[model samples]
Target: MADPLPTSLPQDTAPPPPGIGQLFLGFLSVAVVAFGGVLPIARRALVERHRWLTPDEFTELVGLAQFLPGPNIVNLSVIVGARFRGIPGALAAFLGLTAVPAVGVVLAGMVFSRYGDVTAVADMLAGLAAAAAGLVLAMAARMAEPLWRRPQAHAILIALLAFVGIVATPVSLPVLMLTLGPVSILLAWWAQRGRP
Candidate 1:
């Protein structure tokens, strides 16, 4: 007799593709609330809340976005939108992601121009910056969870080296990418060579 099929198959099924309106509203919500960075919010809404992408899928999308030139989250939105509904969806998601934030930034600039010297405004801005930093740190920790769970020494080594190169030393991003990108790829290939 053949072996029994896995009972957890349903959990692996992909979610339904979202409509254009859903894409727009989802991105719009993420943009409005993500003060310092949109990535974490985007991940939460798309992966956790909307069930649009799995965590591993989201990580892959983020990787692709990082490899591209533009803002990572914006690039991700374009990729996701296009994947779901084509060019129109891409436009809708991009616009929804940027429009209100653009207007809010302009209005904030106007307010700052008027109240640039106000002590209260300065204090509020400082607090916002601190909160933004905390958000970024939290996002970093969350992103690292998968890696930590898998625990590949080479991957962790590369990550640490990249962090130290970028943050502690004067090595620029382009330089590090050029140096480490091929190395990582080669290591991955080598590791998988003996596998089935």
Candidate 2:
């Protein structure tokens, strides 16, 4: 008789790392499909569809990307690409993510310059803005879901503190990052040290 099928695959059997072409095409598809915000779709593609990064990994990279100089998603693409195949991968992903969008923006600018005053154009822009906000919220919830499932109270506390500090108080982003970023890192280190 044939051996019974295994219930679970071994940890060593993780999916093979994606090629540079795959990275380029993946980000290209994300750019094409995402209407108002690319991050939500990017997260879905990277974490769920491609399985290129886990939810926690995506959250961590995005967190780091936010503190970088340029746009967060751009930085994320570069980082993700570099993590896999160094500079070439980064270049491919960056081009795929920005090439189409950059052209679209130029065309859109010309159209808006001509018809910007039209009521329909204004309404459409407003609707796009609202949709962008909703996409951001949805992405936030998905990123937080993994943290909620895990026992990471310190991380949650830090998140809440950052939220309150930004919304309720006058602290700026730099101040919060400088102060709380190290604290969170230390707490994470402490938590990890307890493990075997």
Candidate 3:
């Protein structure tokens, strides 16, 4: 008889390590063109272009990044870079990701400090902020697709609870993290226990 399909999802195979030069140039490209946010571009490069991480892996990495203290993309760069090439990889990714943006921000700051008070400049800045927010929201929706495909309902519930816990309620982030983090893990584990 043919063997039955496994109940649990198969673990993704790790791909070959990208060289430090590729890491630097990939992040440099992401940094240069990413206007509203870097996460989307980073995802495209790491998961889609290079095939370094699968979609599910990318989502998990992003989740871990969100829980950490640093900026999400920065933390992601460090984790992904280190995963592929250790500390030197981490440094290369971090520097490549931030270097150009840092310079741009400094120059923008200099100009804004001079012209920011103007009504036209203020309006333009407001528009940019709105556009950035939209980009982030769109990226979030795209990332949520993997979770939406899971068989368990609690996966979606946990996500909704997290959203409401942070946005609708007055509860602090640290408290929510402490409370929800374990609960989510336990639920996932419980759901997976029935699988072969």
User: Residue by residue across 1-196, what tens digits does model 3's lDDT show?
Assistant: 9999888654465556798888888888889989978898998999888888888899999988888888999999998889888999999889889999999999999999999899999999899999899989989987998877764687888889999998999999878977888999998898889679
Model 3, which residues run further than 4 Å from truth? 1-15
Score every model by TM-score.
Answer: 0.88, 0.89, 0.89
Q: Could you give the candidate ranking by lDDT, starting with the highest? A: 2, 3, 1
Best by lDDT: 2
Total clashing pairs for each candidate:
0, 0, 0
Worst 10 residues of 1 by lDDT: 7-16
lDDT of candidate model 2 versus the reference:
0.90
For residues 1-196, write the lDDT of model 1, one tens digit per residue: 9999987648657678999998999899999888987888999999888889888788878877877778888999999899899998999899889999999999999999999899999999999999889888888888888788888766787789888998998987878878887887788787788569
Using TM-score as the measure, name the better of candidate 1 and candidate 2: 2
User: In candidate 2, residue 182 scores what lDDT?
Assistant: 88
User: lDDT per prediction?
Assistant: 0.87, 0.90, 0.88
Give the TM-score (vs. native) of candidate 2.
0.89
Q: How far is candidate 2 from the true structure (C-alpha RMSD, Å)?
A: 2.8
Best candidate per TM-score, number? Answer: 2
Higher-scoring candidate on TM-score, 1 or 3? 3
